[model samples]
Target chain A: MSAVALESVTVHAGGKSIVDGVSLSVQPGEWLSILGPNGAGKTTLLRVLAGTIGFRGEAALRGRRIRRLHRRDVARLVALVPQTPVVPHAMTVAEYVLLGRTPHLSLLAQEGEDDRTIAAAALARLDLEELSGRELGSLSGGELRRAVIARGLAQAAPILLLDEPTAALDIGHQQQVLELVDRLRREEGLTVVAAMHDLTLAAQYGDRIVLVDDGRIVAEGPPAEVLTAERLASLYGAQVRVLFDGTTPVVVPVRT
Target chain B: MTAAREHGLPAVSAPHVGVPWTLVALAVLAGAVLVGLLVGPVPIGIGPIAGSALAHVPFLDAGTQLEAAQEAIVWELRFPRVVLGALVGGMLALSGASYQGVFRNPLADPYLLGVAAGAGFGATLVIAYGPTGVDGFVLPLASFAGGVAAVAAAYLVGRSVGGGRTTATLILAGVTVAAFLTAAQTFVQQQNTESLNEVYTWLLGGLATSGWGDVLTVLPYVAISAAVLLVHRRTLDVLAVGDEEALALGLDVTRVRLLLVGAATLGTAAAVAVSGLIGFVGIVVPHLVRLLVSSSYRVILPLTVVVGAAFLVLADVLARSILSPAELPIGVVTAFVGAPFFALVLRTTRSSA
Candidate 1:
């Protein structure tokens, strides 16, 4: 069954159509990357899917209209790991990740054993077990990004919406995070959708790519078809060279 | 890590969560309370007088002169002040913590949006001009009204700008409102120089003149407002990631914001109503509590209540007796100590967390 479906999704910001009539669908455990340039409504599209913005069209999760679902209930089914990791002061790694269990908890109920166990397990999955006791303020940017993903994992949501998940990370940490996300999908049947700026990373990890430009999907399907050198150049308005890194098509753009 | 299980308290599965810190806070509160009861300008000793003091009982009628002095001090003189301090302090601290949470800035104080400034003007009018123009309880009532009015004005201005979505705009509106209120207060105070001492002294803030009547008068409102905040702690957690995030978490952002802000305003207004205008307890106490509780309102909120009570009680003790014959306005004492200590804490911590 399809996990999340968006149809004719239109988003406006400052009276301009930022995401105009864009549509996408994801099956269970499938990975989809939404690729676009700066101000190309990449984050905005993620926000719409995350139900953080008002859009004209239908968004459904597991056949339920998104508008009808209670927000915390929706949060339980879908998690959004934003582009930036904004952690409040003095919040411990364990404590921060445990907030993912908030939807499941009653208004006054404190975190039980199962919640802690889930949070610790999620931390372990991301290799953040050692950092559980540390304050979030002390974390490196890469570690902070990992922490946010750990939080998303702790939510145990079927659908994960990530906005520029690897934007601030070093290459090593980027690979570690992406590989962990992929592993989560394969092992736990989690649907992953990331708004990605790097065409190479998008083509590398995504099972399918949706190319968006000027708030609309210019092309969609296999990375090979959607990430053509000619299309990349025209869409981003930059000089770009596309090469096959073994099975994956990688795009390297040169500023003109 | 389910490590500790005690009988009286709920078995805390999350040992690292706020349980231990809360115990520590309770211990400090007890110590502060004891100190407040025992110490005064008149030194009460341990051995001879202490023994005689213990001799007094309900059935035995062994009450001594020492017991009378103790009663006079504890019940008559110091208790009301300490109780008011604790109540007002707790109110300010909780409101501050919640305000900072709502704004998503640690720097945001409880009085951020001109409540104190406008209330200052209203209070100045009452103190300088006297309640002859109005009726009984007019001063505090006017001050409370002004506090609510100021926040309402700021909120309206912010909504007009962008539905309170923009922090910069909200803060700017608050500043404008404050400036306007301050100007009005200055003009009024200048016109009434005959009561300048009264006006300025009230503005500095203290619990010196407030007796049991003032304490009883302000207690219910502050307590109710604080209780309202405590009940809505979880909704505040949703607000930690900004309104958009909280909205996605199924909270009616606008309504919750209004409720939370209103609760804060009510609590702060009550505190101001009783104590005049004590500042920074709201900012400092919550930050300190967050330091101990690690930023959970579940932790910060209750801890702030205990710690704030203890802090204000201690500060009042210092304010009253530090100069013997003359007393400092509790606000001055707190600011003098709080400002330097705040700078030190900021310098030491590097970042607020």
Candidate 2:
């Protein structure tokens, strides 16, 4: 079953449709990258898939309509790592990870031993175990992004949705995060959907790519096909060279 | 064994930290209760008060001097006052904590939604007119009504003017309501010179007018409102994250906010009814509790309750004994203490703002 499927979805805000009639899918154990320029509705589409927004059409997660799925059930199947999640100054890294258990918890219940174990393991995987007791406000930009990812991992959901998780990270951390997601997908049969700015990174890691422009999907397919210089130029409105590194696409912008 | 998780560990540690706070509260409360029984206008030590109330008062030995003093001071003068102070103080702290969680602002005090000013106006009107004007219980009931009405009004105005957009409008509307109520109260107080003392006394707040009946009267209201707030604690935590996430988390954000704000307002108004407008407690206790405990409302709310009860008890004892024979207002003592502690909180924690 598809981990997520959107059908003719349109999102409106402030009397404007941020996403218009877009349909997409993420399959189990597959890594899909959503590439778009700013204000291109990548985030809106993710929100629709994450079941966090009201849209004109349907978003189904795990063969069930996202709106119909109970939030806990949806959360149990999919983990959404929001862009710019407010890292509360006083929350310890451990406690921040514990929030991922909210959906799993009984309405009146607290985190149990199993929840703690999952959180601890996720931290160790992200190399954040040493910083578990540290407050979130103290982390570097790269570390903060990793901390949030660790939290989503702690949720133990099979499908992971990230909104520009590497936007604020340095190039190495970006590579690390993308590599980690790829590894997670390969090992755990996780469905990973990421909204990313760097087409090169997306091309390297994504099994399939969806390109969005001006709140609409323009072209989507394998990177070698979608990242043609003309498609890159039109999608980005910048002249660029799309080179083949033995069948992989490498985007290089050309001025004049 | 008091965890919320199904099969969760009840005895999660840092008992070293948790135990000391409990010990401190117990010691302070014990000392306060002892002193509350012993010291007053009439001299009665613990031994004498205990001897009289337990052994002598009902046994036809009431004719004796020590027993009579015990009866007069311990039962009549001090006990009700101390208990009332604790009840009111706990209610304020409970409410203050609830508001802080709902508004996601540490600066949110019990009076943030204009409950205090509006309630003060209601009580002031009653005082200005005196017994001839209204029936007994009219003051408390009206003040309670006024407080709920004020918060509801603020929420309504806030909703219309961008409450959905941000929490800033609610804050602004609260300030607007507070200003209008204060202006009306000031106008009423100014017009009637004879009522000035009554108005000031109500505004300053105290436990001086308390009796066993007053303590008994407010307890159930406080408890009920507090319990309702406690049940919605998790929803309040989700709210701190933001409306969108909370909605996505399966909580109806609008209903949750109204329920919490109403419960908090009810608790605050009930406390103000008997205790007048005792200041600082609802704001300070939650802030202090958050500094020590995890940011989770589950820990924060309970700690606020225990700490608030202890604080008010200690403050009441000081107010009664500080200048002796003549009592100071409980509100003054709390402000005198709460302000500096708040500064310390600012120094230690980076301001979220």
Model 1: CAPRI class: acceptable
Which ranges in model 1 have alpha carbons more than 4 Å from their true place? A245-247, A252-256, B2-20, B38-70, B125-141, B152-176, B191-198, B209-211, B231-238, B246-253, B290-296, B345-353
**For each candidate, how many residue pairs have backbone atoms clashing (under 3 Å)?**
0, 4
Candidate 1 per-residue lDDT, tens place, B32-100, comes to 766766667777654434445466445765645465766566567666777778888888888888887
Q: Which candidate is the best by DockQ?
A: 1
Candidate 1 structure quality by residue, lDDT tens digits, A177-251: 889899999999899999997788889899999988889899999999898878887887788888898879988
Q: lDDT by residue for model 2 over B40-125, one digit each (tens)?
A: 67766666666665654475564433755456667767888778777787789988888878877676676767888878887788
Off by over 4 Å in 2: B1-17, B50-66, B122-141, B152-172, B188-199, B231-240, B247-252, B292-294, B343-350
> lDDT of model 1 at residue A3?
92
**Model 1 pairs in collision:** none
Per-residue CA lDDT of model 2 for A105-134, tens digit only, reads: 766566676777777677777888678778
- Give each prediction's DockQ, rounded to 2 decimals: 0.28, 0.25
